[model samples]
Target: MERVAQTGSTNADLLARLAGGEHVGEGHWLVADRQTAGRGRLGRGWNDGQGNFMGSTVVHLTAGDPSPATLALVAGVALAKAVTAMAPGLDARLKWPNDLLVDGAKCAGILMERTGNAVVIGIGVNLVAAPELPDRPTAALAAKGAVLDRDRFAEALAIAMVDILWTWRQEGVDSIVRAWLPQGHPVGTPLRVSEQGIDGSFDGLAPDGALRLRRADGEVMLIHAGDVELRRPVEGN
Candidate 1:
């Protein structure tokens, strides 16, 4: 584990280190107190304020393990568990692909990048503060009454991730899906998937990590990539 006062991005820093021939073995983590150029999925910039949690982990995949894509779900499950453990009585749920939600607001996000046989999983959580997002609502652990510090939360997250990664490596995607299902929105929840430009009801996650979307026409679409939003009902419907 390594903690820095500030950096452009933990993921970027680690990637650069790996490119520079730095040996970042599995379970090694890099955390930043603040990030000037942090990023989320789809090239969106992440806000890494002083009180937030910004970190990345190095994972080297071995043969016979599930695809790297499944790491998002693995990270999500671990994060939900860590946050809930830190803030007892707080209900932390996961949004598909990789986002953590409290109530209905986003409190954390996960991003994974692969280099050779190694992958860096970047996670950012709103510990003491949540940033203002343009399209979605955001919340912080403190605002939700958790009041955890960045270092403490980072520590908890790292531990949780280590355990979950072990499960994923030993078992398979089935185990990961089983662990994730309970922490995610229930099957049949209404959703609007932005990338596919489709609105559908949430079916469930496929064993291999694909999101199963049940469309209005009775077609079940397996979406591999998309931004998901809980569909709001019509006022009078």
Candidate 2:
């Protein structure tokens, strides 16, 4: 665990270190108080709230490891567990891939990058304050009355990751998927796939963790990648 007052982007910094032949061990985390160049999935800017949790961790992959992409699920389950543990009954849930939500509002997100034999997973949480997102509603632990200490949350997250990661590697992706299903948005929830320009209902996740989207035609599509959003009912509908 390492804490820095400021940095451009913890994920970028850690990736650079790894590319420069530095050994970034698993379980080691690089957390920044403020990330000037923080980013979310699809190159979106990640808002840097002062008291939020912004950090990156590396996972070294070896032969026989499950798909690297499934790490997103591992990270999601770990994050959801950590937050729910700290603030019990907070209604924390995970949106597919790796977005954390509380009562249908996003509160945190995860980004993963692969290089050589390692994957760097970056995460940001709205702990004390939530950023104003143009497309989605946001929430914060403190605003919701959780009032967590940033440092304490970081420690809890790290511990949770260790346990979940082990399960992912030892018990297989199926185990992670089972643990994740109950923590995620309930099946049959309406959703829209931004990339595919299609709408569907959440059917659940595939065995390997790909999203299972049940289309209007009653056909189930296995979406390997896409920007998924909860399809909210329009007013006056």
Candidate 3:
């Protein structure tokens, strides 16, 4: 683990280190106290909340490994386990492609970037404070009555990730998918695909770990990529 008081972005830093021929072994993590130029999925700015968990780790791919895309599911399961353990009875849940939600409000997010044979997994958790956003609601562990130190949470997350990665490599994507399903929104939960503006119900994940969305016409669509949001009913609905 490498700690810094602040940086532009942990993901960018790690990728640069790798490109410079530095050996960033698997399981090594680069943690930042604050990231000035952090980014999330869809190129959105990632808010830097003091005392939050902001870090990136790398996974070197090999010929025998499962599809690289499925690592999102692996990360989700690991993160869900770590957060659940720390915040007992917090009602934490996961969204497809690795978003962590507490009581339907997002509390954390994961981003994966590939460079050559290495995949960098960056994660951020709102441990001490949550940022208000225009698109959806957000939550923090402190506000939810699950106060935890950033370093302690990082340690727990690291351990959980190592164990889950083992399961991913030893068992398969099937094992990771099975572990992930029960920790996510229950089947029949309403969801929306942001880009396509198409709404559907959560139909679980496909065999290869893609999201399965059941449409209104009873057609099941496998979503490979998109911004998926839980669709809450309108005020008068």
State each model's C-alpha RMSD to the native: 1.2, 0.8, 0.9
Please, what are the lDDT tens digits per residue for candidate 2 over residues 1-237?
999999999999999999999999999999999989999999999988899999999999988889999999999999999999999979898999889998899999999998899899999999988889899999987878899999999999999999999999899999999999999999999999988789999999999999999999999999988899999888893
Stretches of candidate 3 exceeding 4 Å from the true structure: none
Candidate 3 C-alpha error for residue 65, in Å:
0.5
Q: What is the number of backbone collisions in each predicted candidate, taken in the order shown?
A: 0, 0, 0
Query: Which run of 10 residues does model 1 get worst, by summed lDDT?
Result: 228-237
If the candidates were sorted by their lDDT against the true structure, best first, what order would they fall in? Answer: 2, 3, 1
Output the better candidate (2/3) by lDDT: 2
lDDT of 1 by residue, 10-115 (tens): 9998898888888998778899889999999999999877888999998888888889899999999999989888887887889898999888899999999988
Best by lDDT: 2
Q: All models: lDDT? A: 0.90, 0.94, 0.93
Per-residue lDDT tens digits of candidate 3, residues 1-237?
789999999999999998999989988889999999999999988889889999999999998999999999999998999999988889999999879999899999999999999999999999988889899999998999999889988889899999999999999999999999999999999999999999999999998999999999999999988899999888873
